[model samples]
Target chain A: MSALDSVPTAVSRPELRAGEMLAEGGEGRVYELVGRPGTLYKAYRRPAQLAPLEALIAWEARLAEAQPELAARVRAATAWPQAVVTQPGAAGGTAAGLLLPRAPRRFAVRHRDGTSRLATLSYLTADPGQRAAAYGLALPAPVSADRIGIVYALARVLEAFQRAAPPVGHGDLSTRNILWSLERGPEVFLLDCDSCERYSPDGEALDSGHRRRAMTPNWDDPATPAGANPTLASDRYSLGLIFLRVVGAAHFPLQRRQRDSELLSIDFAIPPAARRTRSLLDGAVVWSVCARSLSTRDPARRPAAAEWVSALEEVLDGLGAMSAARAVWAAQGGGTPAPSPTRSAEQAADVRVRPVAMSGAGRRWERVRPPGPGLPALPQSTRPAPPAAAPTRTAAPAPLPAPPSIVELARTGLGRGGELWLGAHRATLASLSRAGRRRRATRQVIGCLVLDFALLAVIFYMCAMVAGVLLGI
Target chain B: MVNVEERYAVFPFYLCLDASASMAGTPMESVNRQLPLLRAAVGEDPAVAEVIRFGVVTFDDVAHTTLPLSDLSLVEAVPTVVAAGRTSYAAAFDHLRQTIEDDYHASRGKGDRWYRPAVIFVSDGRPTDDRERWQSAHSRLTDTGWKRHPNILSFGFGDADPAVLAHVSECKPHRAFIAAEGAEPATVVPELLAGLIQSIVSSSASVYSGEAQLVPPEVPSMTPIPVDELD
Candidate 1:
């Protein structure tokens, strides 16, 4: 098949054509256009902003060409800058349009306050039921294992992309930017490509004097102060948030708010474990990621995508292993059998007691076991037979050991001058004192006597000299 | 001679990073550049190459597993580090703990013995959410003797809480935490990552050799920033 054939032709027919302007962007007019096929197009009218957009497009295209593998993972540009007729007396020049891919299907979840939050796949897939179905299998109840595996897999993908050395980025990486595909899994596509810049591995700009306007506030990192250009680390911060939301967890690290609000707010709480076997490792991993990425008041502490990919992979591997183990447990007889609702009530009390005792043993095993059932029922084969009559046996008594005094030592070292002993040895101190020889006489007293003698001599001499001079006169 | 079977099971290293809005500008760029260099250096050593697996987890307002643990050889390209969003340390930590716990259990199922895993957390800002859950999870790891108590090395990029990093690292007073002079991810990440990789490699090698003594490699020095100028 021809390379062009690989492109989906079903989208070729545009049913919507640009009839009138819908909105004005800094660089272009967003027009509602109808095309040949029932496709609706947002025809962009080239504005003064087109120059920067054009540059970004060219740079992204070049990078994509240089690295085909990396480019393959990203959304392909449908059309490039093509000269087209424009209405007379437009702003700068003849209008040019670039056809882009349509966004994925999305829905908004309304909050109690009537505000709506866009519930994208990144957020929706995080729901346990949704996640289990999406992956096409019943995940172990202790979902930590599955989460770790997923994180690991994602990390691997990131690493592979990083190694490819493509100047590629998900310019607008948010829940909206991430699309789920049954075949390809989670695919990240770059949107607002015109506003994105090509970066070297060192984060230096390939093109100078180019800055794109910020797109969406929701997609931007909450920690960012107002009116700041998004940095590479900022993108990482956003990516981290996306990961947490996708993994069926509670709350984003940074809460989204209006631009005028405070940058930092610690309000959200993480979800509790559903199973004793469910390791909090997943939560820790997520926290560490967010902490490292978002905790740095300075953007520098955030790990690069390459670095994140590696770290995430490790976490996912752990999760995957846990899942596998859970699966094994289920397959074996180790899994707790489902309990009846009536029995579950009694089991609840048992659970409360067991957890308290288990906590002392430093094992979360009780938590991992299926809930609503008392501890695993003892197997009939393993149950001990009734104890036989005890036989009498004689034992010898042993002597008791003496108890030692328990005096608490003060944390502070020796007393006021005790600090001197930190570096100095007693022998060195004695030798220095002896060598100085100041102990033989009272130096202060001797010096005073010498000063007194000198003063008396000076006074007597001065008086005699003055008397002689007066007599001669 | 020591057999391969008797060699220590190399624990994978995961660096769950916070790349939120707080880590923009210098910090993100520093980390991005440092990651590749670290991988290259680690890959150069045959011993490290055989045992150490690396991955990255980046969090912002939301936590996501950007890089899952994989062999170093699998990474063909470097990831572009972008800074955006808020700090979500708590969620990221939870994710890390869950992932590690799962892996430990799975390894046991396969009859694979595991060495204590290590997580090096680098962040510049504070968590933008409740951290109690993360703290509890961290405590659980220590109490459970799970994978050699999962070494947690935390570095504060700039203006980060030393106490938090210490609490996460669970290392002794002087060894558990590192504070970066500036918020440049590029500068701090390399230094921190080098130490992490070095520690893992040395620890694993010592375990394999039955020496019980593993001297950590010298950490790369950070570009000195004048103390007076930091303010």
Candidate 2:
């Protein structure tokens, strides 16, 4: 996996089996690679531009030889083209597809509805509250240090691509093409790398034959003129756009707005959602870099990958200092105690175990009625438990607690009242004459009334004295 | 700074179903059962759902907007369509013209820019209205002068005439489809719907590729109606 050169390039038609189709889309179908665990075969519906695919493979090989550190990052972060799958035809062969490692399991998130979905960028460019409610996964707070961390990670990956022997532009860096995950810190995985726009170091257009070098709708850089292929500048603009939308947690279209507006004095706009979060970008060098990258009509004015990298690094350092300051303040009792940054031992253990949250009845009900006939089946490991395996209620419920007697109630109530005056005064009336009992009750009532009056008088007196003292002062 | 005219792009798809008596049994049932699945399919893929706005229009002797154009992700369920009366192409076309204009303005007001809207017209019979009336309405709906004119895709089966379907699709290649002569309605309805779901998913994906296209459905039991080229 370290070197793309090691991947076997099949000259003959690869035997693709039916029913192994994992997913299908407009462009192509992805199938499980027989006996090649952790690998998948993506077959194109039409012949793909093999030249660019070959160039991409070679570029990565060169990267591995020259810059192993950056190559490792690119290898881990991208589902990069490994080898060309050519179907047997005239002369040599026609390119059909590519062989690449499957997107790792860590990239998929366990949603609240008992399913694991790819943690795509779509999850990032949404209001955190709505995203959490709809998707059942908690995102990092918008514009928080953690969110900036995500943007930084993305920039780092892009930086590696820009540093290639000949820079590569991820032409369509949209919500679907990139995946985000907090499970292993802030990280992103780029998908659909076969469509990546590549150029040779000799200033030749290596991806000229590729038809998919189109910009995604909302994610497109407005500064990139129509009919133009993606270049480093457009990629930089896209990076800035991603930073804005991801950090702001809103679909910000500042570039589009600027283009459409007739008024020349229009100011740069920040996403409204950014105001809701404690933004780490305020007065930061990263904000300036982001603004310059997005606010310019000329692509050349946009910041480079290295500039973004340095800017983001500075922001991260600031975040670290702020976090340290907060910890110190809390330790000195200047603020409420802060929670530990690392999870408790129990929570750490819990993170490794993923128990099904649904009750047995719910699991059985879901199994009894499927979502739809033609719908793709959930992975076997992710599917709910069967009815027979589920726990059932068989034993009778425990008896209810006995009701309290009137005497017990009275005793409890009297005890609660301190019962000082009424202590040792319990009587049956049978032990005394009726007239004597009546007289005793009357006397008790009068005594209680007198005590209450005395207490109220004291309270009033205290209030009056306090009022007089306040007036004198 | 304040943003003016900031809009997110939305590609609207309007499903115009023929709810004439001819579609009452399996056809109508399949439409109802599968329409919600379209919403679910779009909703599951946020990439598609983010830009795709879907609506439903059912026409018999008259037409009704069962569902207004909306982001499918926000839409909970698609309205059920009942079959009755005779088919009226004029009514369907006229209704579509008005609805598309209204939806466009409303969407623009809410900061949504639209790609050309696509109309998916599914029918089981020829237009009951007069030729002049239906043709006039169709012209109005697809008029070059209209800023919001929609790109139409026509699918027909069960007594449906290919000529009429082709005409409705403006005689465009891959724009019109008819069920193979012997295909059953029960089979055709499901396959058509399943293909439609894929077509829509693909068309929405095409937006990512920079060219938003109206990709025709690949129904297994249907064949594209040929349009003769003028010499």
Candidate 3:
């Protein structure tokens, strides 16, 4: 069966004014109407598989009435449900059509030459140079006075959104959703509004009231399912992605390959390089929002939109002050001032100033008063001078003697002999000093050894004599 | 001292989808089913419902704003998915650029400052039309002056070119592409959709308060069968 066979009837052919068909979409076909004043019209085709186009038409009309503000954002059709002739042999039914505003003639941002517009996906993909150029632009600038202002501006924007009455989430936030108008100066705009959701005014803080399953991959929370409810945290997730992209780190925390069935298994990790690129304040704000949004494997722990806003606001305020200071400093040619050692020294000395003594009993003090042309005369003291008080201080105790030095102890060296020889020498000296007493002790020992030896010798002699007698002679 | 009711928060998201002809098969169907599933999941969370907003853009022969920037609540009904078209990435890029520009202004006027939007572009084929247009538009949307660039993501299905999809997405490994291989949309859609939802939720939670430390998601290991093997 043909793709459109399920459609209730074939799309009716509209009269051609000799213009080309610029594009064809599922619901409708866009044609560039010919004439001196050309315009575009998207002719809606009635499909069988889908709901009737009339329902959509009616719904859009109602939406335009109910939310005029929103309707104003889109290029609303000037005329609706224009009838068209049906295909030959097909039932005679009118096809619906609407005239839409023509898109800009120059789609891409143009350079000064206007010849080369800004490179699109095709160019970047085809050329390495273009890719490099795009990356260079996407990467956040280094921390500098200029960057401080940018950070402040970003924070303020975040703060403003957080302070909304019923919190709002740009559910599918990304760089593609942001547009820059290079008129007079750079003006930014956000697009793709179909997925925006408003939190309940009476709901919990940052509570996303989304219950429908909705998201675009890589730019949204992987945990959120189709028909799932919306929450402010989900928007924060998209915002974090945008922040990463602007900083030139395009990939989400998980590698794209890793985003399959294991998405929940993946935890978000901010690259260290990204932190370096982001200002401390911006980094903190970004980190907090992302961390809270991605924190719980469960979505309950994520911070609400209001909470995110408040926290981010504080950071933004601080960033703003820093930026203002940096701006002033830059204006004063203080971009890179040389260090002054002398000034630092003087400040350090000032910081260490001692307190002046106020005791009246101490040494007389003479205050060095500033010199003035006319000095007020000192008032005469009416009180009588009191007698000088005795010194109220106790005398310190005398110092203790120092211990003997190692050199002095070393000087009392060992005697001529080592430890054993010294002992023997001492014994000899003692014996000589008391020769009589020492001789008596020595006699006792010598007598015992001599007597024993003599006895041994006598025994031997007696044995020899007895042997001689026995041999007798 | 602090009123709990006053502490409101909002979540912002942008979907960058690929509407190439190859996406005409089960990939697109799976994506369509998953889109509603994602919305339903978001709605389930009170916080997500209160603060989150969604937008969708489909790119095929041309980038068409199937739905402009609108609150998710406004989409009372789910959109049906129909596939049959060639891939013209340039048109998609142009549409993205235009949509973002318009939405930014609208948000500002409403006194609502927007978080940077995320874009999840899903495709199943290479850019059959002009490549220069897509590149030019991508560059302009993602350049310095426009700091809030969409976190462009590309997903490829069977027979889809990873190199081409990666080029369209801002994310890296530029080779970081997802494919259904030969799996039916019913099976692959849920997995792919679930992965996307999980990524957004985790990333948002991580940065909600300030730049809290982010944890990376763990993706399953799936050996992609070569195209030749797909028979």
- The best candidate by lDDT is 2
Give interface RMSD for all predictions: 24.9, 20.9, 37.8
For candidate 2 chain A, the 10 contiguous residues with the lowest summed lDDT are A347-356
Cα lDDT computed for each candidate against the true fold: 0.45, 0.67, 0.43
Task: State the displacement of the C-alpha of residue B180, model 3, in Å, after optimal TM-score superposition.
Answer: 7.1
lDDT (10s digit) by residue, model 1, range A167-227: 4333455444343322222233234444555557776555435445453534565545656
Task: Show where candidate 3 strays beyond 4 Å.
Answer: A1-473, B1-9, B180-186, B212-231
Per-candidate TM-score, chain A? 0.45, 0.62, 0.37
Better of 1 and 2 by TM-score: 2
Comparing 1 and 3 on TM-score, the stronger one: 1
Using lDDT as the yardstick, the better of models 1 and 3 is: 1
Order of all candidates by lDDT, from best down to worst? 2, 1, 3
Pick by TM-score: which candidate is best? 2
Instruction: Please give the range of 10 consecutive residues that has the lowest summed lDDT in model 1 chain B.
Output: B222-231
- Per-residue alpha-carbon lDDT of candidate 3 for residues A276-353, written as tens digits (9 for 90 to 100): 333242324434444445442455445444343334334334445344433322322122221211111111110111
Tens-place lDDT digits, model 2, residues B1-231: 322223347789999888889898888888878887887788656667777888877787778777777666555556667788888887788778777877887777766788999999999898887666677677767778777889899998888989888889898888988998877888898888888888888888776554678888889899888886211
Error of 2 at A29 (Å): 4.0
**Candidates in descending TM-score order:** 2, 1, 3
Ranking by DockQ: 2, 1, 3
